[model samples]
Target: MTTRPLPEAAFRVLLSLIFLVSGATHLLRPEAVAARLDGAPFAHVATALAPSTSLVLLAGVALLAGGLALLVGYRTRAAALGLIAVLVPITLTVQLAPEALGPLFKNVAILGGLVFFAAHGSEGYSADRALRLRRARRLVPALS
Candidate 1:
């Protein structure tokens, strides 16, 4: 098999897999996902923000959209920010406990990855880079 040279793009796609799958699950199984919120650490606050179903749907949409963008490296920083928005509450409510140390650390690592995208923006093999290149090409042709 040929080796893939674009590590950043590969990392982004790898990181996005969980969000994509989880987002679909949230959207498709809102009731089941919402049930878990009943026992979550910040269930009251989460419900206070919105009814559990509505909250799940909102988070679902955010995660899916953000994951898609991240996977393609389009608006990556903004996408990371949006994922951060969804993840922070979920991490706080669902994964923050002594009994959940493994999941908690996993979420923390995901947060770190998201933060890197937020801080550094897109890498070379990204839609952002492609668009920027296209724009530059058009401008250069116009000037010539």
Candidate 2:
């Protein structure tokens, strides 16, 4: 027998964990992240945002909010789009170097997945579905 694939919800959860951990890491260790970016070409952009720590922490909070929303299937499309917005600049600015090919590829792959999710939405087992179902149920009685 062929092996069964994981459920869509499980896949979503697994995928979302990446962002969750990344966000938490940024929030908990902004200094570490800042240190990594300290000498990067675009470090000035981050510095312009005020202290590097503040900017990094803010990015982390945004990631956390988007990741949490995606995880719960609440406005998943929007959440995915938000992640895409955040990832594009990062991939462009941080991962475009010769030695950064791996990170660049990874970000591109994640971006592709987010684009698909944004287009198709959270297929089922989500707050969006639950709300839709509830609304449909309410409408049915009036139609009847």
Candidate 3:
């Protein structure tokens, strides 16, 4: 059988993997994550919001869940949008420092990726497709 190509889905899955791994690392070692976040430019907002451990756990869980949703192509656009929303606060809070330019660039790149995915559904290899198809079928009878 010929395999259908899914470049968009693949790109999304790869980006999701990156988020998942980062989240897992933070969840597994809150202190380490805390230290890193503390040193970053956006530490002030994080510090103001919650304990370092709690922030790490919350961010980690969000990333993991969002990543999984993207990976499975389930509501992928919504998931991508959610991930972007979550990152915005962190990005603004932490990556504002001049010294944090490198990380800031990376975050910007990820943001762009999230936006791209948000606009384009995961094509054929996604739950969105099934849902869309169902909706289309439902409307067919009325139109006919």
Q: Which candidate is the best by TM-score?
A: 1
The lDDT-based order of candidates, best leading, equals: 1, 3, 2
Question: Which is the leading candidate under lDDT?
Answer: 1
- Displacement of the residue 52 alpha carbon in candidate 2, Å: 1.9
Give TM-scores for every candidate, taking all chains together and pairing residue i with residue i.
0.92, 0.88, 0.82
Better of 1 and 2 by lDDT: 1
Would you list the C-alpha lDDT of every candidate in the order shown?
Answer: 0.88, 0.80, 0.83
Please give, for residues 1-144, the per-residue lDDT of candidate 3 as tens digits: 222447776777788988899879878998998887788766776788888778889999998899999888889889999899778877887788888799889999999999977887577577777788899999999999
The segments of candidate 3 whose C-alpha lies over 4 angstroms from its true place after superposition are 1-5, 134-144
Query: Alpha carbon lDDT of residue 65, candidate 1?
Result: 93
Q: How close is candidate 3 to the true structure, as a TM-score?
A: 0.82
- Give RMSD (Å) of candidate 1 vs. truth: 3.6
TM-score of 1: 0.92
Better of 2 and 3 by TM-score: 2
Worst 10 residues of 3 by lDDT: 1-10
Error of 3 at 9 (Å): 1.2
